[model samples]
Target: MNYFKKLLLILIVLGAKLPLIAQVKLPALVGDNMVLQQNSKVNLWGWASPNEKINIQLGWQTAPVVITANPDGTWKTAVDTPKGNEKAYDITIDASNKIILHNVLIGEVWICSGQSNMYFPVGKEEGTWKTGVVNYEEEIKNANFPNIRIFTVLTKASQKPLDDVTGSWKECSPASVKSFSAVGYFFGRNLYQKLNVPIGLIASSWGGTKAEAWTSEKVLEENTDFLPILENDAKNEKLYQEKLEAYYSDLKKERIANNNDLSKSQLKKPKKEDNKTSYVLYNAMLNPLVNYTMKGVIWYQGESNAEQAYLYRSLFPAMVKNWRNDWNQGDFPFYFVQIAPHKGQNPDIREAQLISSKSIANSGMVVTTDVGDANNIHPIDKQTVGYRLSLLARAKTYNEPNLVFSGPIYNNMKIKKNRAQLFFDYAESGLVKNGDVLKEFEIAGEDKVFYPADAKIEGKTVVVSSEKVKSPVAVRFAWKAIPEPNLFNKEKLPASPFRTDDW
Candidate 1:
């Protein structure tokens, strides 16, 4: 019972304290300053000591979910989120430590996906690549709406499927907006502004990925022509990994070999063995986030698949169906960005995108034909792109009547003795041709040769005829790649690109 006994007790206490203070394991995706999908039940998960009881208290003013840590030291529980309003909340666990999540909100959460266009976020001032940094700065700084949050899935490709991912959710503001998907941020921003609802966006995208990569293997298997992707994966167990390794090895070597730094070598390769093959990206990026809830998907891909535009007739629709089945959302409204006015594509892929939207159930397509810069695939002017997408959602998904969602979409065509009559879906003021007259229509006879048609709007229908062709068998509108297709609704929304005849 002396001073020596007291000193020994203190030493023992300090030894236990060191490890406890260091004991922190957070899921990479769940970290400080991250956005969580709102209005839906969210899963906040992490790991701790084996069999240790854990409690996650979330909300500025409510009850917290409590649970006992599992045998493996991992735990997860769902917390219901509130509508958009920035409010910081404290999460205390085990009466010892607490984590604070600031500026959280509950609202509509959308998965912004597809290829590089969707991932483009480099510029804000010029808009291309979100060049204007100040726009993002102002946006993130005043991100007071606790309702808007964003989560970005880091780009990764796997030869094999992965079950979980590492990322974090943070409230949307200027600081958060910088790293957010430029296209997605603009899209959600437009929707949030219009609807006054909380907005949550999950950015899961890869540059230069094919539509096939977004489709699930099982879903791809449903199509007779697309099943080969899965068969190949099964036959060559290591094909994906080995192929990716070789690709990266070559890519890295090239960067060093060229040393040009400005070589424009496409920088990277797809994450899977077959970058162009179907469902490779789905297995990794998408599959992991399927558990999150929300509205629909906004796609901005197809450049990599441009050469296969003809095949996309089936591939694109299959991708949509696969996602619908995966999400179990039963034909949840899907809207896509038609491939923009990129020069090399010659406008072929845009038509395919239009077809995918029109031919599918509960789907829509936004026309980027009028918005993109031909030289650069990454275009600015995203403000309108997002606004157009919102119009579609507001009209179709939310059933907001009296809302003009799109430009003219081909509704039906009737062939007269010498002319084809085209009926269109939208044109608030009745189809007024842009400028002098309606441009971008073509008529092809049985020989399958097509010539420009002199088309004019007459009482909501456009009658078309080409002096170069007689007895036309099919009518084509906006069929050419980057065709200066000018048809639009009174609302100024461009008509979706289209080609009537397969030939």
Candidate 2:
């Protein structure tokens, strides 16, 4: 072939590839069958050719929104979404190439995140440990909510923030919901039924992962208490590298000794630090979806952080603040499930969650005292968990007036002779004990030695007295691990475990 002809053919091939490289692309959350946050200015972003003019057309709106791509080929703009309805919409983007998203709904979009409980699936999958929620077959058979959409972010861990994630939105069905987060699916299902609007749920979770793994590095660096997390990460990484080197060295020696006749099953490679490593889950799983608009977040984690329960008092709220700040949404509702009763999870972890729910603005906690199993860490009663979370969103977020969503929260205690009269915040309609008598109530004198007390509902307060605890200085309810407290308000929500004294 002639030199001139070869040069011309190369130019033609390069020109064809240029068009493909410069084409517009979008994040996984902004694709087909997705739901946008309702009645708000929702952000839409993507990448195109540098300085290219991008036009976005919403199905409900007449005028097209125009934006120019930045030098790095990134473009972002906000468009107002109307109130949620049953109608499905379409979104079109025009840049170097055209892209269209179909079956887009405007509604309440929620980010469902946490550790294993939130990662629990609706139905069991083969060759996996997720044994499914309670009544796996029936739940899967009944799962047919088309208006509810779910997006499960594939599990990933990154050392730095990522721009995109690997997953796609799917309408809820028996097939799709099988692998979806059971808590997330039930939560969205409740919202769809209550609000009568399309519900979007984004499930970004990792099982057996710590809260620090889902928090940003910058947020952890700001607090000295969280410094230990970063320090431990450094040490684990170093140890992992050493172990990986030793494994390879041993493998090479064994291979030479056997004349490369080794079976793969005979050896195990050094496992890398997984989702437990600090800040990695947030960088890969949560960071990619921050720009996408949502109503709030629902979390069901904390089992892994039980060992450092005191530090979690600070870490939990800081992580909430970190997310709110990153989303630039002012104090959006952040509802979470308190750790259920189990031998591994101590009472102090639940106390830390209680403190965080009170400290963080626009936050709520769902007490699982009534639903927890002492032997089971992943409690099977996710329906109660999801339903309680929806109640908070209904009353607080959706402004369902006069609806009681929370269980009795401890307010104060007064001493009347040898009896301690306990006051509560959510017991306006009065308290009710499910059992013959209130269980888990204890009173302590100056020595702080708590003894079981006889507790009775006295209108909106509980009066507890123990002959052993004369002149009581403090009172506690459900203060031990695996406590089955019978205390509740009229609404049937279980009272959160609480103590009057720090000690």
Candidate 3:
């Protein structure tokens, strides 16, 4: 090289080794056509040069908010948003560089997250239900809710919590809404209709993911019961590379024996990163959106943890509490859909979920016992699920008066001689047998051997008795994996399965 060119190469090599100074950069979430929580302090955050001053000018606000980036290049500020959606707004962030976000709306924002059931979209897709829902065509054809926006988090797994995620907000249109979570779309659509305001749904979910996968590492380590999950993850981290190499070696041998060309796409995909590993999904997907202000969260997970239903009693609630703490939102509405009835599932998982809902503050559970298909775990009737969830939000969260949002919930059981009388909440309007006379009730004596019981709905309580058990000590209703119980409230909502005995 010439003298001047060699000097330039030397300078370039030194520059490559030096740290590149970062300019003002916002997360993909804080982009155009986004919706901020209305009537609340919404968190807006991004990265800038260390100790750089950031001035945020919102079109709605008269005065610009000033903040300073920390030594680590992270900056955050809360902006107050008004309730009405009279006009679109813009946000300009000036730091080392300038970034302007346009067409922002202020409204109710919610996070919809869970497993496969929550990840299922409105449109017909591969590897899910064979066909779309019964009304999928009509629903998608008429879906033109511009006021409702949705942002779906891209699936990722990480060993450590990430500071940002990859996603973008889009207006709910026919094309956009088809691939979005069906439950989330219906929930947002219902909210917009009832409140007459803009609605934003942030969906962060993964198929076949356990609750522990969405929990913080610290939270899992603190509990001794979750030690197994941590230990398994440690083992997975250690052996992942070895397993991947072995898988590729076996695939190569098999292809050679078959005299087939080794196509790159045909090669067996290595499981380098597992979505089921504990705390990875939360680190990559959820951690990045910790303080994005929202009204509440809706969850539809539990099937993955059903095998360890007993442990989930504590773990599920801990995960919720951890999320609430991380979001800095004080017990905002955490509504979840109860798992539908399916064969081969541990019934205890449903019981555990119900307990968690009651234990957690400002939480509601939507019973889906009636709408489930016994054969398919992923039920296609997500419209009912979303509508039911909306009812809970409207009645409990939004203060809608006289709304019947719940079915019969166990209150207290009264034992009179050999018969057990069941008292339930949400039966003020009286109970109604949906179809065949209230089946699936069982009565047991001190021996704890339960027998099929004949139940009679007397007023608001159901009196259950079995001739075989003269001294009934306990009673259970719809307490099986594939129960088809015919019990409901006057409002036509199905009753949640319950067991009076702890066993």
- Model 1, global lDDT: 0.73
Q: Which candidate ranks first by TM-score, i.e. highest?
A: 2
Sum up the clashes in candidate 3.
0
In the range 223-285, model 3's lDDT, one tens digit per residue, is 898998888778977788787888888887877877765654356655655789888888999
Error of 1 at 87 (Å): 4.1
Model 1 residue 334 CA deviation in Å: 2.4
Model-by-model lDDT, in order? 0.73, 0.92, 0.90
Off by over 4 Å in 3: 1-21, 234-273
TM for every model, in the order presented, reads 0.78, 0.95, 0.93
Per-residue lDDT of candidate 2, residues 29-97 (tens digit): 999999999999999998888888998999999999999999899988999999999899999998778
RMSD vs true structure, all candidates: 6.8, 2.1, 3.0
Report clash pairs, candidate 2: none
Best by lDDT: 2
- Using lDDT as the yardstick, the better of models 1 and 3 is 3
